[model samples]
Target: MAVKGHGMEVKDHGMEVKGHGMEVKGHDMEVKGHGLEEKGHGLEEKGHGMAVKGHGMAVKGHGMEVKGHGMEVKGHGMEVKGHDMEVKGHGLEAKGHGMAVNGHDMEVKGHGMEVKGNGMAVKGHDMEVKGHGMEVNGHGMEVKGHDMEVKGHDMVVKGHGMAIQCHGMEVKGHGMEIKGHGMKVKGHDMEVKGHDMKVKGHGMKVKGHDMELKGQWYGGKRSWYGGTMSWYGGKRSRYGGIVFLNW
Candidate 1:
């Protein structure tokens, strides 16, 4: 039996540690560890329930469990969970159930996926994609997919009922119904509505009516109602018979 502390070093028979290093061989296994240097934190346990913590976390055999607050790992068995994820792979096995991803930059391997995008690379299983700049490869696609690399973005993806207005647009479809403004759509079932258009800063404000032009966008001297206007050289003002053109 032997014990040592404070920048510890221990050697008996089945256990050996140098500085803050650790080793537990077999027979009535016991270990307590801490490290900052001296092999810069190393851990080793031959068998039976093992526990490891921080700065290069390592665990071997006997129903392994690992938790990391920051990098470095070596494992014979695996289970992982991440937030603000970054990876280095070894024997990777993945399963995502009812997957929903919002605001995406994707590289996916599929099962059941629901995606909302920004620069995409997808592999399909049960795929549903909502758009902005896309590159897709298909499997069992239930696609509401769009890619012409949208600039000045305004997007709407609806599987049932929808209403839309724009600045820069990208839309993907399922069962789409849109009340318009310079309409562009991908595909499914479509409907669009637009009447009289004017846009400079673009305005639509109506509450209890005083100058009713209820669509969307308002600021400084009224110019909104209905939808559809892309700007350049603006003039056509009388509140609700809107038309302004540029290019």
Candidate 2:
């Protein structure tokens, strides 16, 4: 048997099986929130699987995966909650952050892969694992924040998978890798190739700047690019202005 949830909620359940295979896939099952939550025993020879791939506020178990075969049993994301979440493959991949009123914020992510006669993989953003006599792989990524009352500017941010926030800016990228700026003010520009990067400032400023060039010169009076000269803050004061020269 196979079960999957695209846009719905499945809750509260018990199961018992012998000499058979069972599969659970997609959103909430056997629990209060979204996805499948397993409870009970006698699940011998039972195979179960679950996947949650959607853009919604399910509130629990964003992307969780579970698989079982033969007399073996495998479980992932027994408990989950948050938004923009994802759990993929036979292993669990919990990614994203939880909310907090006046305390610390929590975030987690997990990724794994395995292959063998009897292998298992469980991954989560804020993840935990337990298995035996099988090949198991697990990975987690998390970020926690403290209170802002004492520090005056306290902020907590977490992401189980990959989290990006643009308070007042723009970003562009493709696939898992990203290239762009988190925040840009005026005339400054930047480019990068990686998984994550953040920028914050105002007026012609590049927060995370990376430049590669050959044959650059800085003159005493002003900056010159071959024969053309330009000042960063305008051509008014020579001593208190910044300049850039390209060749």
Candidate 3:
């Protein structure tokens, strides 16, 4: 699953796990924080806001929103849109941070294009992602800071927005290929196309299959890991290929 900056923790998943599902922590998640922490499968935060969708989906945060069957939400201004959706946030809709969807197929337009599907495409500020397989594109792209390391293989990054095409996922960064259990991360923005990818970061998008996305005006020195690079705060590690991605 895709995991954004200080996004969802494994436990924070609202949906109950059943089979092969890796029990992704940050599927369809959004977060903004300074310091980060992950406990069990939950991301307890002290940031702007955090959201997680699951079985009996419910979320809490400033302008937080969750949508699904039997989805009931509670917050100062929260919203959950679906057939059997319920909410308690009085100003949720007014804030425009709220979300709406039917049967999981989502396509939000205008304000901030936040679309959801097997081939998810989002055009907005955070560019968040959710589910097992998805993609996100935004303006805050890439991880650029001191101590950021990406080793081994081809780490080529050249483009504006990060995109992931199904089957043959072609990234714009240095003509990289993450097809077979490979992970591609350029600074903060990344595109994971393989079945099993492992990259780490601090909060924003969450797509299944071990992909993480984090967003911020300024990149922070944090450490976290999955299969390849782990995310940390001013932390360092040794890998294979060392490439530089500047956005």
For each candidate, the alpha-carbon lDDT, in order, equals 0.22, 0.19, 0.24
Q: TM-score of predicted model 2? A: 0.16
Give candidate 3 regions above 4 Å deviation.
1-45, 48-64, 67-114, 118-124, 128-247
lDDT of 3 by residue, 91-206 (tens): 11111121213222122211111111111121112222232211212221112221111212212122422343222223443222344333344444343434433223332232
For model 2, the superposed segments whose C-alpha errors exceed 4 Å read 1-78, 81-174, 178-247
Candidate 1 error regions (>4 Å)? 1-46, 53-57, 61-68, 71-84, 87-106, 110-247
**C-alpha RMSD of each candidate structure in angstroms:** 25.3, 21.8, 17.4
lDDT order, best first, reads: 3, 1, 2
| Residue 21 accuracy (lDDT) in model 1 | 22
RMSD versus native structure for model 2: 21.8
Q: Tens digit of lDDT per residue, candidate 1, span 10-85?
A: 1221122232222233221112222111112323332221222322122222111122221112232122233221
Position 62, candidate 1: lDDT: 16
TM-scores for all candidates? 0.15, 0.16, 0.23
lDDT of 1: 0.22
